[model samples]
Target: MRRGLKITLVAVTGAALTLSASACGGKKADSDDGGGGDKKSLKIGLAFDIGGRGDQSFNDSAAAGLDRAKKNLNVQTEEISAKPDEPDADKESRLRLMANKGYNPVIGVGFAYTTAIIKVAKDFPNTKFLVVDADQCKVEGANVSGACFSEEQGSYLVGAAAALKSKSGTIGFIGGVNVPLIQKFFAGYQAGAKAAKPGIKVLPPKYLTQPPNFNGFKDTGLGNEAAKGQLDQDADVIYHAAGGAGIGVIKTVGQAGKWAIGVDSDQYNQPAVAGVKQQILTSMVKHVDLAVYDFVESVANNTFKAGTKQYDLKNDGVGYAPSGGNVDDIKARLEELKAKIVSGEIQVPTKV
Candidate 1:
């Protein structure tokens, strides 16, 4: 089984129920109770990226928001995951299925859904569609919203931390895919590392895979190999934007008694990687949870609107995680750089 397309209905109380019967193509079902009849009856649908909820990174961060919304906002939710080799048509079908089943505020959790969202949002004019990490749906649609983040801004902070903490002057960067988005991480990281330590040696950026080869986002074997290669070159600290693949990178770094920087979520707090928690210097915390929660809350409060919503360092949408207290000594310096970035004094590059 792919374990990707499983439709799980999350009850308001945080328990997940497998829906044996679905309305559209045997994949999803709407909750009947509607939050114990006290709160607004809203059905929110989420389509996750390749790694799904257990990735302990990107998808898990989005799940955090959905779970929080269910508990605090009293809403029902249906969640589905994307297959590894899923095509654009499959993504469109997933979103269409959610909208057809009366799931309002259908949210797509990755940039891969940009095309699907643009296509599906047109058919269902009533249901709101939100796309995270992408701004493709920010056009003239009344029911579409793009939740975009300045990932480079947060990556810069962690890069500075990596430079400050590295015992060996050389640090490495591991990116999931060779796409512009991942490159943005590289650009900021390189800039921040150099800015923090003028002579810091940032090894050439290495990506697990390129476009059309998205396995980089979920391939632990590749992540391990990449991290090991950098370590062999005497790199003491490593930062990764490789989604679930980052687990392998972190593990390898930890076992070698080296520092690692996590991405998307606070990997230090993740139980899945508890053994390596001590090695995680800090994480580039992109608040996908906050964005997802805000969108759900907007729909519930009848304040939903279309267009682009930016979450950047200035607005606390992106930040560095204070994990393991590894960066405590350099906290003041990091904050100074952050303030400069926010004030436009330090321009974080989005391209390598």
Candidate 2:
């Protein structure tokens, strides 16, 4: 059930929840270009997953970071969506379109573009290729830089916090896919819950087998239905690592008067479901923006490197969200867990 890290969907969180509940990984290279070895200008292309611009997660975070790159680095950028419905579709048409249109470095956000990238990169050797969450992705003609994160460590701390703060002994998690990456989130969350309070029960309403499959993530009705189901089982706090799917869970929790935990980018700040502004206890931050920003900067400076990369709590790449809604009450305990995780006192287990 731990294939969550598959390149076709929500890559990181899908894979990490298995050891207790299992695992997840990305790549890039640089070419020397005369003065200081950095490119004067780069044409960047981004293809987002189906949830599109309204997702407020995953694709949104990637776009936010890339936007920062455009503003700060003066790079040209463009983006398109994969229609989430057909993750495995040969976006070669889109990738080819970008290449033909003069976008130098083409990027594929989720793992869904793995095979497509392998094909497109081969066809466009001169154009650099990038895939987030697909470390093993390689294209012969293009240099593929996969951006990955250590979601387990981040989720563990948040999970631990959830367990510690739960009035009821039950905590919950929802995944976008049931692959290793998403599974890691569940596994780490469970471990953290158990660590926080021995014998704590973690309820998983659903597991996603398809990468980027927001069928469940997209429907507020389903997200709510699933969350309500967990609550019905007596779960007090629900943690959703389902990307846009988590947004639905957050909204449902708000309506149901329960606590919800956000993931990836903080959903508490968005206006989609502001009514439950106070319902979000905290978020499991992946700093996807940081990754995007770094990749763009690296390309500009000609310092890009290849091979899989990991962003964990230690590197300040991932962490719990900032207090926004009604987090004041839990800030003290949250801070305590933060200290332990960052200080290495608490090794938020990445593999069970």
Candidate 3:
């Protein structure tokens, strides 16, 4: 189930419930409980991507960081989900709402919020802003920080795993959207597959949706259709970078007795796709959780740095998962490749 605390203006009782729930972490800035007078607590607000808090992938990773901050750092948090095809104005308003409500270090979870973060950060000089995935927000020395990742490097490892495990010698890639960001995943996968097997047939990738139509990230039917089409063409292994929709790809691949590579969080351990655990070979684990945690921790310590913070394989920020033991036999070989990539012996392309 997707779990989150909601705040609304019309529902006073609901808002009160949110505050009460938040109190579980710590006392809000406005609370007066007798033992202390208006105990101050760090307030964090996050704006999630289309899949929201529990899509079992990207958004869930960010939510995990927030949960950690609430427990380990005793901070209060509020998260809002984006609507399908929402306008940029909506995102700007969401960031403004959090800033106006005195929430410091407000975060925009996906690259979709890049423009909104840059625009909103200018108005609230006191508020710190973070945007994940898009490192191009060049507001040097400003209050905005971009938590960037080397997604292509991680995708390369999983692609090698897929090629190593495939029996049909043919593998495929399924992307959620046809944007440059998702394309990075395909590029790395293609390179890694070829590096592992010279004769391996990495079929042309399939993208479920293009820009302005991001339903591909959340639509299960599209995932199913894309995976089935690839399997029909004799592709025995498939990798998906489709957020919540990737669940559908895994389910279909498992039922067909083929292999499915997961993205973002470790899919082999995800409860939403637990029934198909054995079918998942490995996942391109992106440490979005670490990025969110570090950013919040910096604020709590009063040493927040503005600009871009990059996470890559060298820093243990991204790699392939070993869950389900599906990749145990070939892990040593994967490690060798990982070492080479980290040492600059191999250059994983960010573009296909």
Candidate 4:
């Protein structure tokens, strides 16, 4: 699902410099030159999280936004993937390199980039920076923004779906990393499962790895091991917020004829997981693509705002996907819960 060249920082910088010398005598525009007369498309740089683009989950969703921007906005884009277990300095290098190359509105695709963005944004005061899943860029007058989502809301819906469709009373959750972000997914899932089936047994969330060891997001072996453990414990339905690792969970569950719930993108429709489509009960779809596209559009239209923007079910930003129609029987019920969450009647927990 992820197709593109990985532009190295040094190569991209030299190439961008050559292009800049020819374009506007090395002058960097604060925003896109609107109005169609000598309009210059914005240059965008996206740094991916641990699993990068081909994860078919989180990074792939962000890639969709870049794909749309390339097609509709005619913007130049460069994407770089993070090396597993890389330090924050490496992230800072990635962001600094992009800004130095005149790429405005550079974005970091995960919460891991919070420190990098804050450090790099201070140096490139004119370059706009956006971090997905983080809101720590509140330096006074800094040109940085955060695109956050109500992940708990979407997880809640999918949790209910799992409980309603589950033949067994036991359900399980697997988190890639034992961070607050993944915990949010577990918190909502447990709450929603209990809400739907008061007697449903939601096992303790299993984390593949702890922080600073984000291998959990990419290690399919770990995912498989975790899923098998849950299945052995009589978990008929399992949900995962494990990025690429979830691919293993889906396949393992499919082989065992149990149901698996996907995260970020709709695993039911992802070609990578096509073999297990039927077993995928549902997915908590977080609209990272919309957030990326909207952020780039804001810069292109010279309407860029440096602040945190929250996307929730109220704006169709985050919700559950019924790709395989496995959850169609309970879609109406899910929507009702969605409406109540939007109306503030149901307060989903963000922490377990």
Which regions of candidate 4 are displaced past 4 Å? 1-38, 135-141
Q: Candidate 2 regions off by >4 Å?
A: 1-40, 135-142, 208-214, 325-346, 350-352
TM-score of 2: 0.82
Return whichever of 1 and 3 wins on TM-score: 3
Query: How many clashing residue pairs, candidate 4?
Result: 0
Instruction: For candidate 2, write residues 227-289 as lDDT tens digits.
Output: 878889888888988877777789887788878998888878878868898888888888878
lDDT by candidate, in order shown: 0.86, 0.71, 0.85, 0.86
**True-vs-predicted CA distance for residue 208, candidate 4, Å:** 0.1
Query: How much is 208 displaced in model 1, in angstroms?
Result: 0.8
| lDDT of model 1 at position 309 | 91
Tens digits of per-residue lDDT, candidate 4, 1-352, equal: 2222223332233223212221233323323554457457678999888778889999999999988887677477777878777778778887887888888879999999887898889899999888998843233345888888889999999899888888889999999999888999999999999999899999999999997899999999999999999999999999999999999999998889999999999889888788889999999999999999999999988899888899899998899988878988898999999999999999999987
Candidate closer to the true structure by TM-score (higher is better), 2 or 4: 4
Q: What is the C-alpha RMSD of each candidate to the true structure, in Å?
A: 5.9, 10.5, 4.0, 5.0
TM-score of each: 0.90, 0.82, 0.91, 0.90
Residue pairs with colliding backbones in model 1 are: none
Error of 4 at 284 (Å): 0.1
